[model samples]
Target: MDNLVSVSLRERGGRFHAVFYDPDRGQKWRTLRTSDRREANKRIRIAEDLVSRGDFDPWESPIPDRYATLRGAADLYLAEREKGQLSRNTIRSDRSALGGLCSHMGPAAKVRAVTSDRVKLYFRELIDDECADSTLRTYHTRFKHFFEWCRRERLVRRNPLDGVPRPAVSDALPRFLSHAEFDALVGAVYSDAEAKARGVVDGERSKHTSLHDGDIVWLAEVFFVAVETGLRRGELCAMEWSWVDMASRSIWVPANRRTYSDKDSFGPKSRRSRRVPFGAGSGTEAVLQRLHDETGGKSGPVFVGQRGGPLDGDYVSKRFKEYAGQAGLSEDYVFHTLRHTCASWLVMAGRHLVEVKEILGHASIDTTVRWYAHLDPTRLNAAADATFGRNGDRLRQARCGGR
Candidate 1:
């Protein structure tokens, strides 16, 4: 019925401005501060809505200019994420990446001022600093998300990272421990536990190693479960007793569970649930039983720290490195290597790729194949035998004249 708000392009700098009529202040116009016609139109709708509600303020810009700064936008984005369902580790990672970006490009830099060339330059500097390809990819992804948020909020006309190509990362095969190495690592855990019980001074023990015999057993079980079930460190740390079924020898990783304020929350990386089974004699059942007994058969986390709280993922990794070192394993080995070791062992044991995919909770079979298909040669050999092998056998018979 009425032309409540309209957007017009200013002739001076080609910037779009909002022109609106205010009942209290009579006819009024305010700059939308956006050059893009589409963004300006969106802001005009916002202004119309504000006017209809009788809260229009001509002096104050509809879009807060303060949030246009890179630092301000990043902080707002992070604060919003912190209030959402994202995992703490994920929020921490976003904070770290955004902090790096703000440091690299002066914090006061305007979000709209970021250009593709500037982003490329930042990446180039990162490359010069010898940042790993994976790390570079992480930074790129974080920046892309941040810019997308800015675009959605109308803080920027468009995402600056739209034209930038993602860094190419090498497809390195997953590393795994050999059987001998695995045995040695497990033996080292037991040895360390015994040493601690005997009060023997070992120079190689990590200063953080305050594990008693029970703690040592718990750590060993953590290693066994990680290598056998292929659970991620966070999943293992947040694993609850209810998720494990000793009778079925299965661990149910659930995507949805009621999270109490007193408990740490856990969700799989894929955000999907899957069951991981362990063999009867794999010692997994025994390990779970022992832990169950020690934890008083309560309905709480399966693994806990010295303070009877959820295990810290970082601390588990640190202790794993020390144990790996004591076992004379390669320095490159980390807790995730145990997951790789699990998949490798499963594939080598003739488990199907799809089965390994489900066991490892991989979102796709392609990922399971990419990491472990090569480890299982039986299927490849069988296929070759079914095709070329038959032909070769017939050719050999003909050549020898049925001798």
Candidate 2:
């Protein structure tokens, strides 16, 4: 490997000639020629300084011998992440957050040139204006990650967020489905007409070939899978004929499938990759198997759009609402309601708090407890009893301890 900053010269016709060298294993570096060795040396010095300062990647060309654009700096940051075997889903998530910054901050803004005050103000306004906590956290996480990238690349002299504090949020349980509810959701809830309409499927869902009969049975199955499996919309969409292993009875979560969110208009949710364990005989996998048997199983997305792409989640939400209305379920319920329902069911089943935490991918148990604490009064009561010696004893103990 050749050092990008090393000075090297090739003489043309015995006259002095020089150019900056960038090593490529499978390709040759192209040089921009300079006439004078002294000028060439100056150019080399600037190039080396710029590269050292993280103005550009060591291998990238067209690097300005000056400040790098936020876009350019981002490229360098992302390139390293890509090389590190980071999942595509994770990369996309980070990319969305970081790209949103460049888009909002302006393309010309240099990561190195960005000041502390500007960043502070940016977050301040986001919080003060009452942007959703989740949304603000996304920005903060992305910004901190970008700054960390700068630190790694040596683009910034110091971390911009060193003094900044991330907003604290109480860990709340995510909603999922209950067993009974999931059973009801996947059973014969959808009608022949509604399923025939291919409710949630975007124009992309129609690729399964024309259906002559009711697929409500299949739709019901799909709803169960969503709630039971906790698979995101994109994961559901990207599933293909081969990913399903009926004998093993688990649907393989493909790392390459597109995310179902409209945040980027269309595509995978992130580059983060993981295979989910889908069970056999009941819940989601059963519905998937039924669909597989009907469609030839050799075609495109499992949940094809009306246009033959994966079903858009937004459409799913609307369709779920319609189904709920028809079934007289509450209106406040959304597609996400299934997720909540699942969590509720887990708590109801007396699953360990840690087990629920892992199942939901929650970073903390406090999150799980927050949502399911109502269901586990005994656990809290037990803890309270340990600390204060039962309800009445706690009152007496408090009076004595205070005295």
Candidate 3:
């Protein structure tokens, strides 16, 4: 009662207050609403008993309220998230995950009623529906964030997600295109363009018009830049001509930049800027020069859609899939495969993982190693030979006088 609960009088209001110390929530105060010393003492004793029983939260109500429902708290949580700097996509994902959770667990279910066992059952249902482990992990992450917010807001006594286990996603290697596959993919782009041009000339009914020669060239350059620079689709679409330094052969990917218009705003996924370099002979400079000349305007987006605005990242992925399909590549190949291809090729060419990590703008070297290290078995073999092969044995024998 001494440290866990204390009673104090408000000199100005002439009312008694009950002070309680919660290990998890820290110090909390509750107004006893009585000025009489005897009544305040009785309330203080009750508070002490509640503290001893580990039910000392003053915010918890004896009766169910609107905010006590899962649906109501989730709405408030999402509303608060919308006011922050989080991207719209993040908030949308949060809403999607929460919507599924609310639907599965009855919208009016009490927030406190969501036990760990219930959450485990929900995840089991998701698994039964054949949700991929990666997708399940994303849902789990969103749920964790949502419930943590609820806990901080005192909507629930504790985060139910804390008791639930995270979904286990496999550490599968990233998918990448082989050299022949890469060539075929690029060739497929030109082939499709030519086919469309032929359709236009033959006056055949086609759903889409043929891309202009300049646009075709831009598309090819986009592919080249993606595979070579390992830029994310968002980074590629958001890139500006000014970011390309032809003199230094580097692309300056900014951490975050805001303009007067939201359309022109962009930032790296990691929220850290980096300099991505390209070889002089890698055709990147030539491609940038061609794009610059074709656009006739040097300050706006490096990649633009038919309307000349910033290219949509989602569209880029969809378009890449089309080209991949045309090239007879596996449907699993995605736009991000270009990034994996870049890292894979670099590692195969004897580049250090640290170098690949920097070039790819990865947050950690571990990520670079995890995805590309297995592709460099030659390097590992070479290292092993250098340390324990015939030459190493000879040197050791020479040092030990043939022992």
Against the reference, the lDDT scores of all candidates come to: 0.79, 0.62, 0.77
lDDT of 3 by residue, 166-244 (tens): 9876877788888899999889878766767655533465666655556555566788999999998778888888888
lDDT of model 3, residue 278? 91
**lDDT score at residue 286, model 2, on the 0-100 scale:** 66
TM-score of each: 0.80, 0.58, 0.77
Model 2 has an lDDT value of 0.62
Q: Estimate, for each residue in 160-204, the C-alpha lDDT of model 2 and write its tens digit.
A: 877677767745545444455444444425444445466324334
Task: Name the runs in model 2 displaced over 4 angstroms.
Answer: 1-67, 75-92, 103-107, 171-220, 240-286, 295-337, 354-374, 379-403
Q: Of 1 and 2, which scores higher on TM-score?
A: 1
lDDT of 2 at 187: 43
Tell me the deviation in Å of residue 230 in model 2. Answer: 2.8
Evaluated at residue 287, the lDDT of candidate 1 is 80
Point out the higher-scoring one by lDDT: 2 or 3: 3
- What TM-score does candidate 1 get on C-alpha atoms? 0.80
